[model samples]
Target: MTTAVISDSSSLIMVGKLKRLDLLANLFQQIVIPHRVATEIQAKEDGVASLILAHPLVSIAATTRHELLALLDGTLGHGEAEAIALADEHQMILLVDEKKARKAAKNMGLKIIGLLGVLLLNHRRTHITGQDAILMLEQVKAMGFRVSARLESDFMTRLHNPITHWHSPNTLK
Candidate 1:
């Protein structure tokens, strides 16, 4: 659990909705969401019943790159822009799901992973069972996290064959 990554609001909201925020806690040493991500989640209906910030592992981080954020905000949403800036400034892996945001981060040479990637990480780490991974992936797709048909097929194939899904034992270290 030593890996710490910056997250956009979408993954937080998706995991919260799936009631699997514990996977985040179990996977990362620290789960850092940009301050803008927090605000974005709070703007949703009736204001953040999820309370992901209340968790011991989750922390709100702010980015100082105002100019970068503004530039990113031109093409991305405020939360996504701020999240990208934070991940870039800190040089941490970004947990983002949007296609455009992912593209932006990759263009900037920043590491990016989706919520489904988190699921794969968890499965690889044995934080989640293979059956649970399949179920969760379907649930995430149903929740509308932009799972392409090919990606979904790939995930299912991997989930069904756990023997090949294991990372090196040191993956957690």
Candidate 2:
């Protein structure tokens, strides 16, 4: 896969779960964060920012005014806007979780995926086991990330095997 530039909120959420970061860093060629996103993270004084900065696969890039405005006009919120802008300017995939922002990105023909999507991809790639994927999802939830019931169900189905009962919703739940 090509490099993906994540905006602040998603990166913070991802890095907060160290295991998720380990998986992502291994999956992608590179992970870039806009300078604005980095600045926001730096202000938090949490390990997320430091971890991202220190990661060999991750880097920061400054965003321009034009790109910022375009993002603002897009469906992205302030933080996500900067991320999308950076991704668009660099022709990289934008890793975002906001609904409106995702819709806007799709409208603009930009490749986008949310936190759940990333986790699912990791699970599919065998970077994380099905159980670990569920654990990561729970961790993100504890950190205040939202996951819709439908999305959760869909992901669980992907992790299930038709010939076995290991991942049946009743058993997993």
Candidate 3:
């Protein structure tokens, strides 16, 4: 709970829809987000927006890296650009789901993790069992959070053999 993470809306919305937002609270001490991300979450009109805003660990923060932000704005969504800028400014890990955004964040030397990685962390932490992780993945898929067949297989492979070798399948990358 001492570690803070900058996140965009994709992971938040997807997880929130599953009634699993507490997974985030359990994982990070603070969940810092850009105002734009907050706006997007709120726009969903589900209870998630209020729940997230009410969470003690969730904080709306502004990005100070204007030059980088401006450059990112041309290609990425406002939330993504701001989240990337904020992560770069603070040198914090970013929790993002989009491939392009993840690539952009990685290119900037920012540590990034996606929604699946969050489930991986939960399983590794023993907060959820491997079977439970698989079930969660199934649920995620059912909720229309796209996961390629190969990635899901890799995730299951990792879930079953988490202790054998760490990060072998490299799905998170």
Candidate 4:
């Protein structure tokens, strides 16, 4: 089974925009969003807020490590810092999309996943077909997810070569 996931704002926003929050719901046992991340997403007029609010497995977690958060305050967004701190406290995996935040979380020794990673997970689990996965990836990328050219190309290449790429989704790191 996949590890527990704590999501930041970007992952929520991206998957919410894709209307595929169900993917996260199915991919992980539970998903915890940090309080600051929830606050940042609360005002958004996207499907993510409603889905997060209504989902039974999704909950908001407050970060108590003020010093850790303060240290990361300037380097990362409030939501990202709180999410990272919360994940660190609980020893859960992080689901973040921002490049800098992802790098920081990794530097802190946290296992990380991103929006595209979740999609790929679904595909690996046979929850979605390769074609469907590719289509969803294209949709998210087109919606301004800021995927690097090499990563985009890699996903496409992997999707087409299942024999070699049929590894665990956690390899997304």
> Candidate 3: which stretches are off by over 4 Å?
164-173
Q: lDDT per prediction?
A: 0.79, 0.66, 0.82, 0.80
Per-candidate count of clashing residue pairs (backbone under 3 Å): 0, 0, 1, 0
What candidate 4 gets wrong by more than 4 Å, as runs, is 163-173
Model 1, 1-173: lDDT tens per residue?
65798989888888888878888877788889898888888778742435687777788889999999989989999999999999889988888888899888878888777777688778888899878888887787787767888777776776666565423221221
Tens-digit per-residue lDDT, 22-56, candidate 4: 88877888889888888898888765788776778
| Candidates by lDDT, descending order | 3, 4, 1, 2
Residue-wise C-alpha lDDT for candidate 3, range 1-173, written one tens digit per residue: 43888999988887777778777877889999899999999898768898778878889999988999999999999999999999999988899888788779878778887887788888887888888778878887887788888877777787777764334232233
lDDT of 2 by residue, 1-173 (tens): 54555555664556554545766664578877777677777777656677777878778876675755574855556666777677667766777777777766666667776666666666766777888878878877887778789878876886674332223221111
Model 2 clash count equals 0
Instruction: Please give me the total number of clashing residue pairs in predicted model 3.
Output: 1
Q: Which stretches of candidate 1 lie over 4 Å from their true place?
A: 46-50, 161-173
Order of the predicted models by TM-score, top scorer first? 3, 4, 1, 2
Q: Is candidate 2 or candidate 4 better by TM-score?
A: 4
In model 3, residue pairs whose N, Cα or C atoms come closer than 3 Å (at least 3 residues apart or on different chains), thus clashing, are 1-29
* TM-score of candidate 3 against the unseen true structure: 0.91
lDDT score for residue 4 of model 4: 74
Q: Which is the winner by lDDT between candidate 1 and candidate 2?
A: 1
